[model samples]
Target: MADALTYGLGPDWEPGEDGLPFRRAARVVVLDDDDRLLLVRGHDAGEVTRSWWFTVGGGLDAGEDVRDGATREVFEETGLVVRPADLVGPVLTRSAVFDFARVTCRQDEEFFLARVPSGHDFSHDGWTDLERDVLDEMRWWDVDELAAAVAEGTVVYPETLPELVRALLDGWDGTTPHLDESSVLGPST
Candidate 1:
């Protein structure tokens, strides 16, 4: 008989008090007109790792402020300039140990919500050193559609993102967001 799949799967639990059951990372969620969320499809490094449908954000650099990193990442990935807005909230999502193995180090990721002006153009060429792979395609969809995609694994955001979106929509008056340095993003991890 063939060995069970779990035979070589190793223990189901994580190790060390600091070694979390899941990997933590940061992201930025940008919603555009037509109510569709913007997502980037790219590589984390130079490898053919799993593709993700994520907001325009990425890992915080060593000693980098959260908001600067978020905006810089957005510009690098999408070429759209934006001001960091509200703190949608924080998310503590998990990932397999193997997924984070390639990362030089690990920490809990922080996220912030930024508003993209309707008239702002995203078609430009800008680059960041941390960019794993460049993603040119962008898409938008309704919240319900997004939720379905997330549930079906067709769309992926940070684990805490959906709830944050719901909260933003519930309280949003569509007014211009008040941008500030203190209101900006930085690593909370």
Candidate 2:
């Protein structure tokens, strides 16, 4: 549910697949000093049972730089202020289509990497109404826990997220991966 319309993005919409509104977003894959990754749990607004875990980020504003947008989104969603310079490579680029808040949307997203202190403070003080409706739980997950969750059928975006995290934890290779449509997890059930 990283679509712009689901999180207070501008009204500027680009038509996408089958005339669905399109948006551009900047997402952050946040890792803590302890090597745990921080993610947020989101439930489809129209169907709470349709849930998944994703990184900390959301739609960017028109003309907003990706790194700036990523840091801004982090503060808005987690109450932690991150500087743009602190953000690492927009390590991944992706296109995703899905249903959120009852509307199907297409989004182009750039994912960046961030490292924060363990147990960094998080607050919902800046959430938009739509965000409050969909994003609820936030947690730091270790690789094994994420693997176990996925093994149990928990839905996570970009299906190979665990592997990506594992690789990043081992050390970023400086290559920007393109997670094409094939990587998107599709519409919520």
Candidate 3:
């Protein structure tokens, strides 16, 4: 419990016997005009030596609209102002059970698509202390690069991100794909 609070999980944070936490997050699959995707790199606070790459987003505020939450996450995490109306689709959804900051979180996440100009500099704004402690870097990724990273034993959440990004190369086809069944994310995942 002290570990959770120390990592800024909040005083209200408490997991059940199975370490089941309550979370609903939003993610933006940010694609630049050059076909590169934006992602962030981080690790569970207790496992700082091992890191994973994931899209830029976070949990929604209570009662927030989905797209609005998605866009808010984008701006807060990346300093990229994405209008809610400009986001493409809630193109994907997934259930993720993962460990971060020594807490096991079960997050139901929605993925939105945002298009940015090429080489929009990374100027993250308003990251909480937890993010500063766990998040390491933010970068633009090409699809093949992501695939290669995964192949080389790097953990990337939504393990199929490369494939999904490839499918969106021409634009989302008006269908939202569920990325996975409820699954734990890790190296073997």
TM-score each candidate: 0.58, 0.88, 0.88
Cα miss at 83, model 2 (Å)? Answer: 0.9
Off by over 4 Å in 1: 1-26, 43-49, 84-105, 128-136, 172-189
Find the candidate with the highest lDDT and give its number.
2
Q: Candidate 3 lDDT, tens digit per residue, 1-189?
A: 333355566533445445565567788899999899888888766666878888988877778888998888788888888999998888999877766656566677888888889867766667877777778898888889889988999778788889999999998999987765456545211
Output candidate 2 Cα RMSD.
3.6
lDDT of 3 at 129: 73
- Name every residue pair that clashes in candidate 1: 23-95, 25-109, 36-141, 66-185, 66-186, 67-185, 67-186
**Residue range 60-79, candidate 2, lDDT tens digits:** 77899889888999999999
Task: Please list all clashing residue pairs in model 2, or write none if there are none.
Answer: none
Q: By TM-score, how accurate is candidate 2? A: 0.88
At residue 19, candidate 1 shows an lDDT of: 43
- What does candidate 1's lDDT look like per residue over 73-112, in tens digits? 7777677776555444432232322232232222344556
lDDT, model 3, position 150:
86
